[model samples]
Structures are given as structure tokens and as C-alpha cells.
Target: MIELGLPWVLATLPLPILAWRFLPRAKERRAGALRVPFFDEMIGSVRAGVLGRVKRFGAIAAMIGAWSAMVVAAAQPSWVGEPQSIPTQGRDLMLALDLSGSMAQQDFAVNDRPIDRLSIVKAVAKRFVEDREGDRLGLILFGSRAYLQTPLTTDRETVGQMLDEAELGLAGKETAIGDAIGLAVKRLGERTAEERVLVLLSDGASNAGVMDPIRAAEFARQAGIRIYTIGIGADTRAFGGLGLMSLGGGDSLDEETLRRVAETTGGNYFRATSTEGLIEVYRRIDELEPSEGRESHVRPMRALFHFPLGAAFVLSAMLVMAHVAGALGWNWTAGRGR
Candidate 1:
């Protein structure tokens, strides 16, 4: 349906009449008047009949059409479609994932069967990303050295791919928790303080990085960046031996470093022992950082100038026909006076 954006502007429809009423007339020039020979004879035949009436009515109709065009322009008529809105307060988050060799440990249980830590983390983290519908999220995978696998972006699909493609020992055999945080901060430098966040998940401690984990956490705190840390490994008792020796029955994880990182940055630390625990951890994070924000928007408008433009062309064509038919310029006195 058609609608006017500024419907109040329709009140200006009487502007043309007001112009005709209040507009001042130009002063007549004081040029000397010239005498005409047949003025009296022209006055007698002035009542030309049908042609005269047609000329007068046609001129009035043309003026009315032009005025209608102006009124429509002022009212700003447009097509009304569905309304749209988007969140305005979501933060820019960077997911710093740990792909160290220990992440391959099948100590965590998923549906009563042992699963790798990386697999559990992947599933839970992907769900968390999906829940943050409006936030611009980025991915960074690290093991021994920290590197940005994927920069900050709004395309969650691409970030998910990068996360899925990450291998156990891609960055290295060891985890570089500090380097990952530093890399995330670098990428998040473009974002504002309130919008910047780093979420890091690791199954082991930082053992091989140029930057120290404590120092990195301090840097994040100084930069006003929040870091949510997750330790993704089960205790020794969480694993069981099936037939022979249990592989992950006696493995350990670095919870202290992860907790310190989170605390220093004014964020919380979570431990994911079982797959269910991982899901609950993600749910808690969601509650803490709810994806709610103020939304503001402008309604879109489409131009409709073509409708009046086509009418103007048709009117011009009619005026041309009238001139060509010799119906106009046949004033009663023109032939006699000339």
C-alpha cells in the first residue's frame, strides 16, 4: 500500500491558492502606449464559442495537474513494507581456542562414551556462538604459539569453519594461552572498550609462548578487555579403563592459570570435566553476557517521481497537439489587426 512519510505535509495543499491570493503583482511598466487600428472591431467578435471554452478549460486543467504533482512531492509518498530492526549493544567477541595435543585426550564423556576434549569444546562453543546472534565474533586457534586463525568478523559461519578445521597440534604440541590472549587483544584493538571481549578455552597450561600468561592477562586488564577462560579437561577419576590400560586415566590440566586469566580481566573461569559440564558452562556464559541491546532504525523510503513525470509528458503532448491543430493562437483580433 502507498503511504505518506510526512502526512502532515498534506496540509500544504492549499498553498497554491494562498500564493494566488497573497502574491504581489508586478508593477506595470510606464512604456508609451501604442494605438491599434482595429481594436473596436476585434472586441465585437471576441465571443468565439466552443474553441474558446476548450482553451480556457484546458489551461485550468494543466495548472491543476502541475499543482497536484507539487503536493505529492511535498507529502513524500512511498510504498509501505515490513518493518526491520537490529540490536545496537552487542559486543565484539574473539574466541581464542586451544588446539594443543592434550585436547585430543578422550577423558571427557559424551553420551556415556569417552570423547576428545577438542570435540566437546567445539560442539559447545559453536552453540554459544550461534546464541549470540547479533555480536561480531572472530576465531583464533593456538597451541604452542598464538596466531590469528581467523580475524574479527561478523560471519559466524566462516569462524565456525576455522574452528572445525583446527587440528590438535596445528599451532604446536603445547598450548600457548598467553600468546592466544595477546593475539586476540591485537585483533580486538579496533573495538571499543565496552565492546571488546576474549573467550579462551584450553585443555592444558601455557608452556611454549614468548609472552607469559600472567603478563598477557595483565595486559588485557590494562586494555580494559574482559577474558572468559575455560579449562576443558577432566580430573584423573573422570576417565575409566575399558579392557586394558586407560589412556587418559591419569592426565592433568592447568586450572590455576586459566582462573588467574579470567580473574585478572574481571571475568569468570569455568571447568568442563564432562560434556554436560561444558554445555552448562556455555549456558552460564550466555546468562552473564546476554545478547540484548537497544535497537534503533530508520524506515526505508522509495521515490515515486516517475508517476508525475509521465503525466507531465502526456500533458506536454496534448499541448503540442492543440498547437499543431491551429486551435490555439486564433484570437479574434489577430488576423484583422495584423
Candidate 2:
């Protein structure tokens, strides 16, 4: 729909009339009458009195039209487009994934084929990101140090692509769980306290980095960042005829520290031993932290002042050309009669 931004400006449309009626006019100078023998000839030379009056009326009409166009332009007419839905508030979620050498373990399977831990994570996390339409998501890939793979943004496709391109041991071979949480807290601290969230997934303990896991968790808690820790990998596996053997012997998996980090920030700890379990863990997190409910809208606007302004210029030009043509025609006729 078309609208006027400065509708009050239209009130000035009668300003010229008001000034003409109330303002004092210049005094007309009086001259002594001089007797001239050719005064009758001079009067007869300008016999197009009716044509002169018509030209004067045409000039007034042109002036009025130009003034009207200028007034319309000053009113600031614009076209407003349809409203579009936009998210006013949504969760700011940061995902911190372990990129230590242990992430190469082929414990998870897809289509009955063994896949590495990172591969499984990339696949499942991509789906999770796609589902989070309104929320802003970020990625932090950590090994011995934590670094931002992607900043908090609504571009989920790029974030997913960044995760997929992550290589194992990109940040070094040892896990830096504390550093990951610290980085997440730093990034999410700028956002609202209620919507800040960090989901950290690691199959190893914090054997590297300057920050301690418990201390970092405390920092995150103080910063109002909810941390969800997931300890991935199978705990036990049975051999052909032997009893169950614990697969949690290596320094790779650390459930205690992960649990403490989650508990400190008032979030739940999840364990994913298989591909299905990993999917379920993300699904549960999605349920826990929902996207914003309230909706906002904005309408696009296009200015239309130029159209009226251009018309005013064209009308004024036409009036000037007409006056010049009439003056030239009168000169030609006088020259012919002479």
C-alpha cells in the first residue's frame, strides 16, 4: 500500500495563497505623463491584448501545477510492502566438539558400516543444526586448544559445512575440555543470560590446556551458560565366547569430568555408545532448549518522492519554453509589419 511519511507537510499547500492575501505588496512607482506624438502608434503596435491575457493565465496554471507537484514530493510518499516474519529472540547455542586423535575411533556405524566418532558427530550434528531454524548456532573444534570454527550466526548451512570439513587432531592430539568450555563461555557471555547454551561432546579427559575442567565449569555457571556434556563411546563389548570386556580402560574416555561440567551448569549429562544413541542425545537436547516462540515482522518500504519531483521539473521547463516561443513569435510579427 502507498503511504505518506510526512503527511503534515501537506498542510503547507495553501502557504502561497496565504502569503499573497496577508503580506504587504511593493508600492507602485508613479511617473509624470509625457506627451508623445507616436503614443497611439505604440499602443496599436501591441494589439494582441487577448493573446497576452491567455499567456498570463497559462503561466499561472503552470505555476500552480508545479507547486502542487513540489508539495506532493515534500509529503514523502512511499510504498510499503507486505510484512515478513522474523525471529525477535532465540537461543544462542554453541557446539564444542572434541577433535583429539581418539575421535578417529570407528565405534559408531552407519548402514552397518563402521564410521569414526567425528564422522558420526558431523552427520548427527548437521541434522541437529538444520532442525534449529531460528536459533543462532556456533561451532568450536578443540583438541589441545580450543578455537572458534564458526561464530554464532543464523547461517546453519555454513556451520554444518565447517563441522563436516573438520579433521581429527586439527587442534592437536590431546583433548582440551576446559579450554573448550572457556571459549564457549567467552563467546556466549555477550548474549542474553537466559538464552546462552553450550553443548560439549568429548570422548576423552582434559589432559591439555591451561584451564581446569572444574574451574571452567564454574566460570560457565557464573556466566549463566548452560553446558550439556556428552561422553561418547561404548563402555563394554563381549568377545566371541568370553565375558564382557570394558572398553573404557584407555585415558580416552572421561565420564566423571564430563558429568561434573554438566551438573555444575545445571544441565544434563548424556552418554552415546552408538549412532542411534547419539541421535537420541541431540533430540533430547533439542527438546530441553526450544527455539523462541514470539514472532516479529517488518515491512519493506520504497520511497516515491522522485516521481512527483520529476513531474514538477518537466512542467516548469515547459512553461519556460512556451514563454520564450511567444516572445520570439511577437518579435517576428512586429518585424513583418514594419
Candidate 3:
């Protein structure tokens, strides 16, 4: 589609014609007449001029056309492409995953097969990322310290890949729940008032890092960031030739701090004792903060002024050349007579 940015500039298109019709002419020169040596040749050349009324009319038409083109260019013409959907009320959500040394514990199981906590988290978190369409997603990995793997963006693939590639000791083996929440709050706080949310999954309490979990949660609440905390670890592990004994259980899990952090941000905390439980926790969180359907559209625009501006330039150049050629022809005629 074509549009004009400065349509009012087109009003100047008729100025030249109006001036020609109504503006007073300059007084004719009244200087002493000078004799020309080739007066007869000049007169003869004028009589044999190349253009008559048709040519004169053509020149006037060219002037008007060039002026119109110039005015059109000044009006700032543009070409707008097809409409594209953009999320207008989407949530700015951040996912903070635990990468502490404890995350390497073989507790969560998938399809009855044992897997480490981080591996299962990578699997489920990738799915969670996929489901969060139309929302800006980010990845934060924390062990002894928190690191923003990816900033807030609509590219879920990048965020998912970052989460999937995370390894233990990337930030250290000790869990830094406080650092993770603090980072999430800082990043989410930079976003607009549009729904801000964070999903933090960890297996241990704040055993490392400088900041305290409760203090970070308080900052998050003040910044209007809702955090859903998940404490992941099996309540017990199986032993060969022995009934399932108490091992890899929530013994190391800090449910109290996690619950307090979630509560401070007006969010909830969940304990994932199994792979199914972890998946269910995410599903429930999805239900709590569903992607908004509200959206808007905008068409990309490209400036088209150069077309008319180029035309005006070409036309004006042609007119100047024509006038120069006419003058040269008259000079040649007078030279021949000499």
C-alpha cells in the first residue's frame, strides 16, 4: 500500500502556476542599446529556430511535470507492506534454573529410567519454553552465582538451547537461590509494567552467594515480579536387593525458603519428588500464567520519495541541456556568418 507522510506538502504543487498567472512581471531593461556585429546572422538564426508553439507548449508541460514530481517527493511518499501480528499484552517471563553440584544427583526418573536432576530439568524446561508462545522468555542459570544465559527475547529457540546446554559448575557447585532471584528481579524490573513473571527451579536452599533469598524475594515483590519457586529432589531412592531406603530425598531440599520466596512475590512454591511431579508443577504454573491472546498489527513501511525526487532531477537536467543546446546553435549560426 502507498501512503504519504507529509501530505500537506502537496498543497505547494499549484504554486508555480498561480505565480505565473498573478505575480507582477519585472520592469523591462531600459539600458542604452548596443550594436551587434552579427545582427543579421542572429536574426536569421532566430527565424529558423527548432521549436514552434508545439515545442513551447512541451517545455511548459515539462516544467509543470517536474514541479509536480518535486512536490510529490517533498510530501514524503512511502510503501507499506502487509500487516504483521505483534503481541501487545504479552508477559515478560524469565526461567531461572539450578545448576549447583547437587543438581547432578540421580533422583528424578523418566520412563522408569533413572536420570539426574539437571537432565530432567533440561527436558521439561525445553517443553515449557515451547509452550510459552507469544511471550518473551529468558534463561538464567545459577550454581554458586547466577548468570543470565539469555536476555529477555521472543526467540524461544535460543532460550531453550541455552537452558539445554547448561552444565554443572558453570557458576559453581553450591546453589545460590538468592543470587538467582536477585538476577531475575533486576532483569524483569527493566521491563515495562506488562505482566512480569519468573519460574525458579532448584534442589537446595541458599547455601552460597552473597544475597539472601528472602531479601531478594522482597526486592522482586517491590519490582512487581511474580516468582514461582520449585524445589526438586526425590524423597527416597531405590537400593538393589533392599527395599527403597531413605536416600536422594528432600533431605537437602529447602522447602521453607523456597515457599517463603514464592509467597513474598505473591507466587507459589512446589516440591517435585518425581519426574511426573516436576512436569505437573510446570503444567500448573502454565495454568497460573497463561499467555495472553490480546495483540495488535503493524505494517512495515519503506520510503518511496526517491522515485519522484529522481524524476524531478532527471527532468530538470534535460531542460537545462535543451536550453544550452539552443544557445549553442545560435552562436554557431552567427560564427558561420562571420
Candidate 4:
């Protein structure tokens, strides 16, 4: 539909008419004429007079049309598109995943084939991100150091893509859970207090960062940021036909520290021993949200003033050309009468 930014501008449309009706005409200025003083012309002068009057009427009509077009343009017409749902400012949730060398363990399976822990994380977390339509999501890949792969954004696809493309030992081997939590807190500090959240997942303990995991969780809690800790890795899995890779990967998972981090930040800690367990843990985390939250919407608008503005210009130009042509015709006729 078309809308006007300044509807009041249309009221000026009748101003020309009002002035023409109420105002007195200006006195005509006399000009030296090439008069034929010998004899007066009959049929031709009358014809020229009639043509002049017709031209005058045409000019008046064209002037009004141009004015109307200009007024419509001035009113600022716009074409508004259908309303689209805008995801309102929901939770500023950051997902911090471990990128240590241990995450490369092939203890998790997909379709009965063993896959690395990080692959399982990327798969399940991609699903989690898809379901969170209204929330802003971020990604942090931490090893010996923390790296914010994706900042807080409504573009969940970018976050998921970043997760999928992540490699092991990107920030060096050994988990830096504390640094990851600290970075999340820093990034989420500017957001609304009650809505800040961090979900940290690691297969092993925080053994390589400068900050202690427990202390970082306390700092996060103080900053009104809740942290959900996910400990992921299977306890056992058979590697090949020869024998089993005993104590597969879950041995290094520091459950006690993860639990303390979750408890300190008023959040929960979940243990995922397989791909299915990781999916279920994420499901449980999904149920912990405060609300679905509110959503706002807007229509895309395109300014259509230029269309009518161009029309106004064209009409004015045509009128000017017509007046010029009529003047030239009158001059030619006057000269021919000699």
C-alpha cells in the first residue's frame, strides 16, 4: 500500500485555485508592436485570437496538472511492503565450546559410525541454534586461549557455520574454560542484566588458562550472567575389530568443577556421554529459558516521491515547450500578415 509522510501537504493543492479566484490580475505591460498601419486584417486575426485563447486555456490546464504533481511529490509518498516478523531483543546467549586436542576423540557415533566429539557438538548445537529463532546467539571456541568466533548476533546461520568449520587445537591444545567464561562475560556485559547467559561445554578440565574456572564463574555470577556447563565425552567406545579403546574419552571431564561453575551462576550442569546424551542435555537446557519473549515487526518501505517528482518535471517541461511553440507560431503568423 501507498502511504504519505506528510499528508498535510495535499492541502496546498487548492492554493493556486484560491489565489486565482481571489487575487486581482496584474496590469498588462504594453510592448512596441510591429503594427501594419495601412489596412486591418479580417479572417486571419480572428483565427489567431481564437488560437491564442485556446493556448491560454491549455497553459492553465497544464500549469494546474504540474502543480498537482509537485504537491503529491512533496507529500512524500511511499510504497510499504507487508509486515515482517522481527526477532526482538531476547537473551544474549553465548555458546562457549572447548577446542582442545581432546575434543578430537572419536568416542561419539552418528548412524553407528564413530565421529569426533567436536563433530557431535557441531551437529547437536546446530540444531539447538535453529530452534532458538528469537534469541541472539554467539560462539566461542576455546583451547589454551579463548577466541570469540562469532560475536553476539541474530544471524544464527553464521554462528552455526563457524562451529562447523572449527578445527581442533585452533587456540592450542588444553582447555581454557576460565578464559572462555571471562570473555563471554565481557562481551555480554553491555546487554540487559537479567538476559545475559553463557553456555560452556568442555570434554576436559580447565588446565591451561590463567584464570581459575571457579573464580571466573563467580565473576560471571556477579555480572548477572548465568552459565550452563556441559561435560561431553563417552566413557567407553570400541575403536576397531582388534580391541576396544578403553577409558575412551570421558575420563578427563571434570564434573565437580563444571557443577560448581553451574551452581555459582544459578545454572545447571549436564553430562553427555554420547551424541544422544548431548542432544538430551541441550533439550534440558532449552526448557530452562525464562520465556519465549516478545517480538517486534516492521514493513520495508520504498520512497515513491521520485516517481511523482519526475512526473512534475516532465509536465512543467511540456508546458514550457508548448508556450514556446505557440509564441513562435504567433510570431510567424504576425510576420506573414505583412
Candidate 5:
């Protein structure tokens, strides 16, 4: 579709014609006239005969056409492409994962091979982040202190990469669940209400941080930020013969606090004992907090005023060249006659 940015400029299109019809002509200047023996013949050649009248009419038409082109250009014509899907009203979700010493425990398995908790998390969470089509995702890694590993962004691939590069005990050896929640709430509070969400996964209790987990959850609830808490680690030993050999030193997970935090923020709590369980938890969260259903669209526009502007310039240039050629012909004729 073609549209005009300044449609009112088209009102000036007929101004030139109106001025030409109604404006008083300039007084004839006798002093500027040059003495020539064939002055009458020259005048007749330009304005008297049928060909002369045709040339005069053509000049008027060219002037009108050029003026119209200029007016059209001033109107700012543009070509708007068809509307397409664009991200709007999508949820802004932040993933806060624990990087404490306990995350190094090889309790989770993938493809019949044992892997550490953080490794399984990176693999499963990376896939989850990649699947989020319209949601803006961020990453926060917390141990002794919470760190914004990646700010909220629409670039899911970059967020996933940052998660993959996270190392165990990089922040510290203790968990700061409260600090992680506080950071998420602080970052997501600035965004629109009802679209802010946080997914916090940890294997241990909050043994570090200045803020209390319950207090942070209350603040998040006030800010309209929903938090889904996941307590990850095996509750029982994989082998019955190996007594007292449970995952993560027999469940350091503070499940009660995690549940309260989730409840305070109008979210859910889940326990993941294996890689498959962890994946399932994330899948359920995905279903619970789905992307916005409201469809939004944007149209791409390209300015087309330059074509008309160029046309006007070319027509005006032709008029100037015609005047110059006529002046040169008259000079040559006058000199020859002399």
C-alpha cells in the first residue's frame, strides 16, 4: 500500500495554476529591449504560427508537470509492506540458577551417562530458553552472591551461551537464594506488570545473602513478579546397597523455604531428582507461563519521494537548457546578420 506522510501538502498542487491565472503580469520594460533589424520576425517565430503556439503550450505543460512532481514529493509518499508478527506484550522471564559447590554433584544422568547438576541444568535450560519464541529471557547465577550473568534480552542464543559458560563455585561456595530472588525482582520490577517472571533453581538452602528469602518473595509479589522455585537433587540413593550415599550429601535442599517463596509470589514449586525430572519441571513452567496470545504486527515502509523529486529536477533542467539554447541561437543569428 502506498501512503502519504503529509497528505495536506497535496493541497498546494493547484497553487501554481491559480497564480498563473489570477496574478497581474509585470509591466513591459522598454529599457531592457535590444535593437534588432529582425525583432518582429524573431517574435513571430516564437509566438505567432501554429508550431509556435504548440511549443508555447508544451512549455506550459512541462512547467505544470514539474510543479506537480514537486508537490507529490513534498507529500512524502511511501510504500508500506504487509503486516507481520512482531513481539509485544511477551513475558520477560529471568532464570536464576545456583552455582554453589553442591551444583558439582554428579547426581543427574543423560543418555545412561552420569553428569553433574550444573551440566544437566545447562543442557536442559539451554533447550528451554531456545524454545521460548517471543519471551525476553535473562540469566542470573548465584552462589555466595547473586550476579546478573545476562540482562533481560530478546536474544535467547546469547543468554543460553552465557549459561553454558557458567562454572561451579565461580561466584562462591555458598548459596544466596534470597540475593538471587532480590536481584530478579529488582530487574524485572521496572518492566510491565503481569509480564515479569523468574525461575529459580537450587540444590541447597540459602546460607548466604543480606536479604531474607521470604522477604524477597514478598517484594516480588508486590511488584507483580511471579517466581517458580525448583529444588533440584535426589531425595534417595540411586543404589540401595550404597547406604547413606544420597545425591548432594543426602538432600541439603530447603524444600519448605522454596515452597513458601513460590507461594508468596503466586507461583509453583517443583522437585527434580534427575535430569528427566528437571526437564519436566521446566516443561511444566513453560506451559503455566505461556507467551502472550495477543497478536501484534508491524509494517515495513520504504520512502518513494526521491523518484518524484528526481523527476522534477530533470524537467526543470530541460527547461533551463532550452532557454540557454534559444539565447545562443539568437546571438549567432544577430552576429551573422551584422
Candidate 6:
């Protein structure tokens, strides 16, 4: 369906009628050297017939057509409703993952089968990342040191690739939980304070980095960045016959430090002994740092100007053809020389 942007412009359509009714008409006069003074003889005697009346109305129709075209142009007809806006604002999140040797422990279960803690972390983190659509996400991998594996980006595929290729102890074999938090804080500080968030997932305490966990959390707090900490492993457990058959024992997660880090930054701490629990923990964090924003007002619209434009073009075309056929008695060359 055709549409016009400024329908109010159509109110000017009857302008020509108003001009005809109220405007003073100019007296028409003719001057010539070899011409007769009889108006009937020169202008053609009045002929009352169907064709005569039709020819008289032809000028009116052509004028109407031309005026209609002008009206359509003034109305600014357009193909409206082609453009649209979508809900767009989202939070900026930095994900810091621990890559220490203890992350290799196969104490975590997926589908009732034992999987390494890092493996579960990867799987659950991928899901969590997928859930954060429209949000800018960053990744940090840490062990003895910390490294920015992926800078803040909206591209989920690249972040996923970085997570997949991440090896245990990519930074080293010791957990630098504090350094990871510090790195996250540093990166998130560059973004909007209200939307900046740091999510740190680790199975061990900080023991190999220059920054302590509490100090890093303080820095994050000062920057108005929230830090959500997840302690990702269970305490040591032993069986009689197993004789400590590698229950993934000895490695421990510093929940107190993690909780303090979260509290200091007005974030939360979660524990995940199993893979399912890890998925739930991330979901809870998602709830805390929601992708929220206020929506702006959009102007409502309607279009209705194409009718006059189309009518004008069709009428103008008919007028040209009619004048060519002498239907309106218009003669450009005949009226020019004299």
C-alpha cells in the first residue's frame, strides 16, 4: 500500500479552488496588426456540443493534474515503516577462569560421569556466555599469573574459541585468584560503572600472584565494579579401600576469601561441588547483574500522500498526449512568433 509522510499537507489541495473563488481575474486582451476585432470570429464562435464542452473541461483537468502532482511532492510521500529499532543495552562482563593443576581433578560429574573441574567450567561457562546475549563479554585465564585471553567483545564465537583452547596452567600451575580479580577490575573500569561486572571462577585460593584477593576486591570496589566469586571444588574426601585413591584431595577453595572479595565489591559468592551446581551458580549471578536499561520514546507514524502524486502523474501524461492531438487547442509554436 502507498503512503504519505505528511498527510496534513493534503489540506492545501483545495487551494486552487479558493484562489479561483476569491482572487481577482485579469482581463484578457489581444493585439495584432492583421487581426479582426470581432471576438467571436477570432476566438472561434461558441459551439455548444459534446466535443466542445469536453475540450473546455480538458484545460481544467490538466490544471488539476499539474496541481495534484505539486501537492504530492509537497506532501513528501515515502516508503514508511522500513526502519525499526531493537532493544539494545546490556551489561559488560569480565570472566576470569582459574587454570591451575588442581583444575584437572576429575571429581566433578556431568551426566553421572566424572569430568575434570576445568572441563565442567568450560562447558558451564560456554552456556553462561551464550545466555548473555547483547552484553559485552571478556575472558581472563590465570594460574600462577594472569593473562587477558579475550578482550571485551560482543563476538561470542571468538570468546568460545579462547575458552576451548585454554589449557590447564596456561599462566602456570598455581592459582592467582587475586591477580585475576585485579585484571578483571582493571579492564572493567574502562566501561560504564553501572554495568561493569567481574565473574571469577576458581577451585583454589590465591597463592602465586603479587596482588592479594582482598586488595584486588578493594580496587574493584573503588572502581564501582562488582565481583562475583565462585568456589568450584569440594573438600577432600577419603574411602577405606580406596586409601585416598585420588579423591582429588588436598586442593581447597578459599571460600572465606572469595566471600570477602564478593562482599567488598557488593557482589555474591557461590560454591559449586558438582557441574550442575556450577551451572546454577552462574545462573544466579546472571540474575544479580541483569542486562537492564531504560527504553526511549519512539514517535508513532502514518503515511498517506501517494494518491495525489499518482493522480498528478497520470493526469499530466494525459494532458501532454491530449495537447499533442489538438484536444485542448494549445499551440506553443503558433503563439510564439507574434
- What TM-score quantifies how close candidate 5 is to the native fold? 0.60
TM-score of 1: 0.59
Model 3 ranges with Cα > 4 A deviation: 1-86, 237-249, 293-338
Model 4, residue 118: C-alpha shift (Å) = 0.7
Question: Could you tell me which residue pairs clash in candidate 2?
Answer: none
lDDT of residue 42 for candidate 2: 57
Q: List per-prediction Cα lDDT, in the order shown.
A: 0.74, 0.84, 0.85, 0.83, 0.85, 0.77
Put down candidate 3 lDDT per residue, 76-183, tens digits, no spaces. 999999999887667999999999888898866666788898998999999998988888999999998899999999888998889878998898989898999999
TM-score for all predictions?
0.59, 0.59, 0.59, 0.58, 0.60, 0.60
Query: Weakest 10 consecutive residues, lDDT, candidate 1?
Result: 240-249
RMSD of 1: 10.7
How many clashes in each candidate? 0, 0, 1, 0, 0, 3
True lDDT of residue 266, candidate 3: 97
Q: Which residue runs does candidate 1 get wrong by more than 4 Å?
A: 1-87, 238-251, 293-338
User: Native-vs-model 4 lDDT?
Assistant: 0.83
Clashing pairs in 5: none
> What is the per-residue lDDT of model 1 for residues 1-338, given as tens digits with 9 covering 90 to 100?
68876788778777888988999988987988878797666444453522454476786687677667666766777776666775576778889888878888787786688888888788878888877876778888898888787777767788888877877888888878888888887788767737678888877767888888889989888888889987766656644323111123234566777788889999998876677767887888788877654365655667675676567667666656655444334543466556
Report how far residue 59 has shifted in candidate 1, in Å. Answer: 45
Q: What is candidate 3's CA lDDT for residue 276?
A: 77
- Per-residue lDDT of candidate 5, residues 1-338 (tens digit): 99999999999998987998999989986777667897788776544333332376777887888999999999999999999887566799999999999999887677778788899889999999988877888999999999999998988889989998999988999999999999999999988746799999998999999999999999999999999998887656452122112243245888889989999989998877776777788889989998773367889999999999999998898777777666666666567758
